[model samples]
Target chain A: MEKADHLSMKDEPEVQGEPTKTAVHLSTKDRPKVPGEPTKTGTSMVDTAAAAVQSFAPLNQIHQHLCAFHFYAYDMTRQVEAHHFCSHINEDMRQCLIYDGPDPNARLIGLEYMVTEKLFMTLPDDEKKLWHTHEWEVKGGFLFMPGVPEVMQRQDLEKVAKTYGKVFHFWQVELGHELPIGLPNLMMAVTRDGQLYPEMIKETEKQFGISIEKERESRAYMKGPEHGIHPLANGGGKGLKLELREVDIKPVESVPRVFV
Target chain B: MASSGDEDQVPPGDPVTVSTLVIDAGTKIMQRRLPVKQMNTHVSTFAIYGGDMSRQIETHHYIHRVNDEFLQCAVFASDHSDAPLIGIEYVISDRLYENLPQDEQKLWHSHAYEVKSGSWAYPRLPEVVASPELKNIAKTYGKFWCTWQIDRGDKLPMGAPELMMSPQGVGQGVLRPELVKRRDEKYNISTDELKQRRAEIAEPEWINPMADYWKQHGKCFVLDIVTVEMNRNEKFP
Candidate 1:
């Protein structure tokens, strides 16, 4: 089986055929001459000028190899609703989009993070306190990659279960508001059963039409020595003791903004 | 349907987005010959200090290769399409920052305040996407230098490479609102609101020791021809 290509050029070269001399004559007659500029003949000259302008068009460069994953996150401050569709940025760093629903017109509500254990371990002890491990999300079947085969999903989950993520929601879609309002609030995933409103997860499962019990059962293979939490994860570190709490840190709302 | 075990059965494009035709990772795509302007999401504006420390030049940075061991950012005068390229800031991981010699390390600045304070943000992206990028950026240290002082109205890059650094503390009045206002007007966010949000993020106790050394020393030395010439004249006179 051939592997799928990830980076194929979208543009194909244009084939040049015979150029008519009549077209060149007509173009020269129609073109307005600029003051003190030499009159140009030949379609080749015109084509070169057109090509020069075309070269200036914005070229889209593939900056990084990207892959997408889905996530289920709940607001840490509110702790009522679970948002869906969190995506990752380079497969290693998780960047999830918080949408209102599964529909195409779903409102983009917030963003979340999933970092590899390797990256998470390097964060300072203070920063680590802001992030949460995916153990409960994985073990409880609350988090699962959608659309992929069960085998592939299991493989992805094994990698995901070993990582940590931080979530922040700018739009609180759960309050029945039509638009995202207020400042961005830091969000958290349920690290334990009964921590979040159980009904919210059930509602999310119903909306997505997936059973958490079955998802959890399928991910049983991800358990064991390979998926154990990193020491630095869950706010645990050498010589530093910190407890994860649901405190609202409002001072972050004051960070100065600059237009980019 | 073909068995999932067959790798070829997995289609040629991304399963989610059908319009985007992709080559397999194994296929080598030609590097873009044309100068490509990719929109780097995590772009932040910095008031870089010069070698003399009195000169503060505003710079816009578009960060790339962020997930890699070394993060690279292209400095621009503005976020506009025609914004001139002024410089580059190369950030390395703490592991790499630690290995640099004392003299070399003095050039880099700690991102703890920049990240924690919300000074560094994804310019045009939604909050959901920008937050994690900022989180990832907080972990690294950057060494920035600007060749073009676009703020000073130099049509082209002139003079020696000026040392660049992020603001050390919040509300230090280091970041100019006039410059930040132009950026906020472009992005549709108030700089005051961002300043308010930044205050909530706790400052990290552990900062890059290199940044600490430079802070105490109160000067950044850049080897430049202009400085050498001036020093030579002083010695000769």
Candidate 2:
């Protein structure tokens, strides 16, 4: 079988003799004046300068990319594809910055923090409801991390299966907002069949050249959360509703030790 | 997939005889780029919690300039390769910031002090190449959040996220001498010297009073998360 063209892009990072560089001239007068040109150029030039001296220690750790879908807590009917660029802080937790697509032009939509079940239980009841479980996304093969082998995936998926994530999205792409204008919205993951758009699943499968059915079969034996998901999680099946209210920032005790 | 059985198929006398390498060589690699790959710029600075100015953390920002209107960064605890990602910051031009409602404006802070005090650093860039751009960033506003307080030595990012403020005026903005001295030693650049170089860039007179609320109004904003009925006869807060 001929592999999917886009899937080949992930499987093979660089193609030999394919002349990847392309340069084109632009007629600036033909279009409306674009904004922020100076900053963009400044970034490129400064990044070039910084690249010679400073090391990007933390960013270099983001090697894993997971493809999944998310729903707005206020309205589960609105869902979107979420691509996660993640790194492990430790076995107990992982943090990820999410974007709309995997390509260079993708929009950065939000971020997420995933914690172990042990840690999840430590949270206050109110805080726990803000998070969603990942058992279905993993065991049902709704979530996939590309480029790694099945062996490596199974190893990580085992841990991911038991984790819970709290996500916030700044961009309302589903609402057709041109810019990220409003307050960030809380995002949740669909827990069962028919919740996620099936078309997205089919599209993800086509683009990655993988089988969700096969993945589900292999992950069937993995354990779910030991005590089952807390009732408070996923809005307690009450349809999570999010709101922003003003709260006072409390003061922390001053550090007694002075910086000498 | 690279096969263990293909170990013998590697070209004879090859210095690195790996089964995976042989398979990779046969299939070749493709050039595929990602959005995060364009995140080449790095800025190092410090931020204080909005609710309390005493709680501060050193921030390393790897920026991806989306356009003229916004520059978002993935923040880390340290400059080390394995440093934890402590939070995220969304920066915007003064024009875009001015358009935001008064309440939304409170969530952001100004960068004039960070710039004027010479506290922000461009790490590898020479002062000459960076100063011009730093001048532009000096007038901008930033909304930063620290998911986990690395300074407090938390093992995990627990509790709700904290909204961070940039040190502003003299009484409200003085950073600990130790933090300054340590940052200078790591980058080997004197804040005093950078301060002098940046003095010519006058502060923006139009800084919104709504911004840097902790500094201006003596209070800070906190995240309020709650679950209510979605279809209730009500409007969003």
Best by TM-score: 2
TM-score of chain A considered alone, across all candidate predictions: 0.55, 0.77
Q: Per-residue CA lDDT of candidate 1, range A170-238, in tens?
A: 433433332222223344454555544444455456655678788777777665224466554432321
Task: Tell me how candidate 2 scores on lDDT.
Answer: 0.67
Worst 10 residues of 2 chain B by lDDT: B1-10
- For model 1, the superposed segments whose C-alpha errors exceed 4 Å read A1-260, B1-31, B34-39, B52-54, B170-173, B195-202, B212-214, B226-237
Q: Which candidate leads the pack in lDDT?
A: 2
Candidates in order have lDDT scores of: 0.44, 0.67
Error of 2 at A147 (Å): 4.1
Q: Judged by DockQ cut-offs, is candidate 2 incorrect, acceptable, medium or high?
A: incorrect
TM-score of each: 0.38, 0.78
Q: Cα deviation of B58 in candidate 2 (Å)? A: 1.2
